[model samples]
Target: MTSAALPPSASVTVRVPAKINLELLVGPPGADGYHPLATVFHAVNLFDEVTVTAAEEWGLSVSGPQSLGVPVDGTNLAAKAAQALAERAGVDEPVHIAIRKDIPVAGGMAGGSADAAATLVACDHLWGLGTTKQELEEIAGGLGSDVAFLLSGGTAMGSGRGEILAPVLARGTYHWVLALSEGGLSTPAVYAECDRLRGSVAVPDPVPTPEMMQALRSGDARALGAALQNDLQAAALSLMPALTDVIDAGLEFGAVGGIVSGSGPTVAFLCEDTESALDLAVALTASGAVQDVRRATGPAHGAHVIGGPRPG
Candidate 1:
């Protein structure tokens, strides 16, 4: 087996994007399934930059607006990726990671997953492991359901507990306006809320059919906008009742449709274009229901190689 060796003072920088679920359908309860889901994810330009470097020992240092609750030790997914790679490659070298967070943590933006993907990519290059993108994605998938998407980046369909992926043809930039929340809503908690809401309604439905995927490919803004749906919205609204007004406010300001980004709290508002997105951002920032607002675009590429050496 190969081993990872990190030279002291080695460092690399990586930029990773947040994700938006374009469409999500909830399925019936399984033995373990809160509900099987069908989701189309779009990686946005909004990102958290991570700098990894070699140190005397393994450690993590996170800085930025959204670092709270993020683990700096082995518990962090970035650290976990480093350890996993070390074991897999049979390398013993310490790594030091510094995450400069731009993506909102726990805001349903896949900030942690992005960091993990960046770590895997940066560490591989830093150690001269020459691990392929596919190999990195496989390891990332092991890290979490959303981890692979972080590696893949861009527009893609997620199914089978959101691990399986089919890259979609979302060309041209799709603009977005994100409403930041005060804190995060737990994924498990959101799923549980869906289950609880499901108990009150009829049995959950099956995942969306291929037609929905075709709709995204058609790229008609209205068609895509009309087709956008989320199984988790009920749970998200249940957890944060105020989200209802947030959605309404976004629509009132001329957004096509607004939905919770992933689990809860953060809401992604689909806009007509980049100009409209900026306008919405300005307006939504003043809206009382949110913390901050950001403009983003989709059909964007997933994680990519940067010119720098890997961080430790």
Candidate 2:
């Protein structure tokens, strides 16, 4: 369905959730240098906000805990998303984008991808493009692999460099304790390390385990925790050994399962319930095993408008 047409002075705001990989099985690198993946993505309550307003020239700004590292120029994914949508809609008028981030930067939580997804939705609404959901998804895929998933947050299976998606049935919420690191891990560097580590070994096709799916369907956190896995964990740990300490600490604090969220640095611990998550967060914070400890629940809704159009 189409939204009401917005005036040239109208603005739109969208909120997008950060994602963690419950399972990230990676195969050998393809000709394109990207490893094939079989992954289950879970969107957490952590979010980044993007607001778009009509402007004379395309401009961008960021403000939040992690904003210092985010680019405000064309290099930013949000700006790229806006340009892509403008080209598709054949509108030359520019937009001003403002971002407020809570998701950790370069923590493998797809924070940039979340902003990109939010920009696409906000701009489409602001410009009254009336783009279909499928159209937006197609655009999202071009922006990045994880961007598509950010467009429809929840539990889902990702394949083909993580762009192709199939929604998985997830029964209930899962509590998580995220241990944020002081520094970010480069995604490309982690992938290269994975390739280097597996130099001669014949890699098998990545596949998701049935046990994990069953646990999700049953809403059993412990079972799901036992099934949590990430092929990139070894490489991530190799690059940043300090993460090992964080993982150990989380488990010691009574986490059922813990894994590097995606590529590196940030570690996510699965807790049995809300109370357990709070306890874990408190312990992790007090122990100083990480830079910061935050609690979140999954699966959260995808990129969605949180502010209505108002006269400029």
Candidate 3:
């Protein structure tokens, strides 16, 4: 039996979950544009599905509520994944990739990264390339920072521009209330702002705190909430100053802890349990400080096949 999910037919569909950074420590940008990162990534229930079908020419389409402004061309990360896989396998035939997005676009949830990871899995199965997990991760590394984490799912520590991965000892599921924004913040812009805020201060290398690691290991919700940290939080707040009100509302509504999700606009509120998440979601939605409110459980599975591996 193959360890990897197999494609049953001409088309392969894969579902991938969105990711949130539980702890994000970003260092100054090196010679390369990317900032050094030490982050704890947790996949959430929010998902996007990508289906790939063999086609004479390359094509892509995006649908679902958050598909607006998404590129359906080569520029799309999904397309890049497929093309890269094809190049790796020396296959020239093209496959059309269709993405059904439920994850928020550019919402600091790594929606695009999830789609890219799904496409990689789907196309690999479609072509019967027999790509190993390590090989796939190598391809994913170039696609985006969060792409590699989405491929493995669960909880992991990411370094080296968030491409390098190491598993974390996360013990249990975590409840969260996400205050999503209608408009997205550009990650690059947020990084620029972070740099601007730092000004001339010498940036120190980043490391995940032992307290945060201990909380995840112990599966203590309150401890995790208290330990939640994101270096990008201040930058995100600067970009969307109104986000302060959202954070305030989450805490006011009894969230154990609240911080900007990754970049800007979306704020994550940690709750004690599902009951707390439900109440926080309702309160955040009613507060009018956020565009939308979503409750998600974290440590969800990463990209995996949910469709057929039909009899060939």
Candidate 4:
């Protein structure tokens, strides 16, 4: 099937989920200046859509709710995936990709990495390259620290600049209310902010908490909520003090706990149920701590192609 009929030059759309770091720990900055981290990443329902179509020359056209900020001219992660894959597969035909950004950019949700992961999977099928999941994950890891989570699409412990993965069992979907920020925040900047807030130097924690790992396995919402701590939260809060209100309002409205998503300034709240998530979202919106609110569930699947969609 790899060579037969050229697969009809079809269009494929993959839905990619944004990720949340249930527990994010930042250690000393490496020689590369990127800190070592131990984090538990969960794929959430909030997603960005990526569509790929065959074209004469490799190119990317970005559009969607937040497309205006997305770079398209070969700088996009999706474009990079296409170039890498095409070179590896030895195909000359360029692939055209359209990205619909639903997940907020720079929201600490792995939006760009997710797009790259989606493109790798969709194009594998669209171009009939026949790449395995393991092979694709190898490519995904090179794209970003969180890219592998997009491929695994579940709970996993990430270490080593956040690329190494070991899956964890997280039972039941965790409801969440996400407060969207007005604009994006840089990941490196957030880390730098953490360093600034901490001052000159820092020390690594003893190790990943046994309690945090156990809570995930137990799958209790309250337990998980209590365990939701990001070492970067202090830095994020220090950098953007306004996030304090966002975090406060979420909890005031009955959210179990709240923290800055990924870096900042998107805030995520853990709720008891779907109804509670909605109520928290409404209350938080009324509080005006953020631009908008979105309710979602944790541990959702990664990017996969949709049956119908075309880019003309």
Listing every candidate in turn, what is its Cα RMSD in Å to the true structure after a full C-alpha superposition?
A: 2.3, 2.4, 3.0, 2.8
Top-lDDT candidate index: 2
The lDDT-based order of candidates, best leading, equals 2, 3, 4, 1
In order, what lDDT does every prediction score?
0.80, 0.91, 0.88, 0.82
lDDT of 3 by residue, 1-312 (tens): 123332333788999998889999999999977799999998999889998887777899999988998998889999999988888878766788999988888899998889999998987777777789999999999899899999999999999999999988889889999888879999999999999999999989998899999999999889999998999999988888888888888999999988787885788888999998998899888878888888899889989988744223
Rank ordering of all candidates by TM-score, starting from the highest = 2, 3, 4, 1
Candidate 4: tens digits of C-alpha lDDT, residues 24-89: 988878788988888888899988888887777677877777676888787888898877777777
Residue 151 in model 2: lDDT = 91
Q: What is the TM-score of each candidate against the true structure?
A: 0.93, 0.96, 0.95, 0.94
lDDT of 1 by residue, 1-312 (tens): 544554576677878899988887877778866467788888999988777787787889999988888887788988898888878877777778888888888888888889998888877877788887777777887888888888878888888767778877665567788998887899889988888887767764556656657767777665666677778888999999988988989988988878888886899998888788888888888867788888887755566656566334
As a TM-score, model 1 comes out at: 0.93
Candidate 4 or 2, higher TM-score: 2
Q: How far out, in Å, is residue 216 in model 3?
A: 0.5
Pick out the ten consecutive residues of candidate 3 with the lowest summed lDDT.
1-10
Off by over 4 Å in 4: 1-9, 308-312
Q: Using alpha carbons, what is the TM-score of model 4?
A: 0.94
Residue 137 CA displacement from its true place in model 4, Å: 1.3
Scored against the true structure, residue 250 in model 3 reaches a CA lDDT of 90
Pick the TM-score winner: 2
Query: Lowest-lDDT window of 10 residues in candidate 1?
Result: 303-312
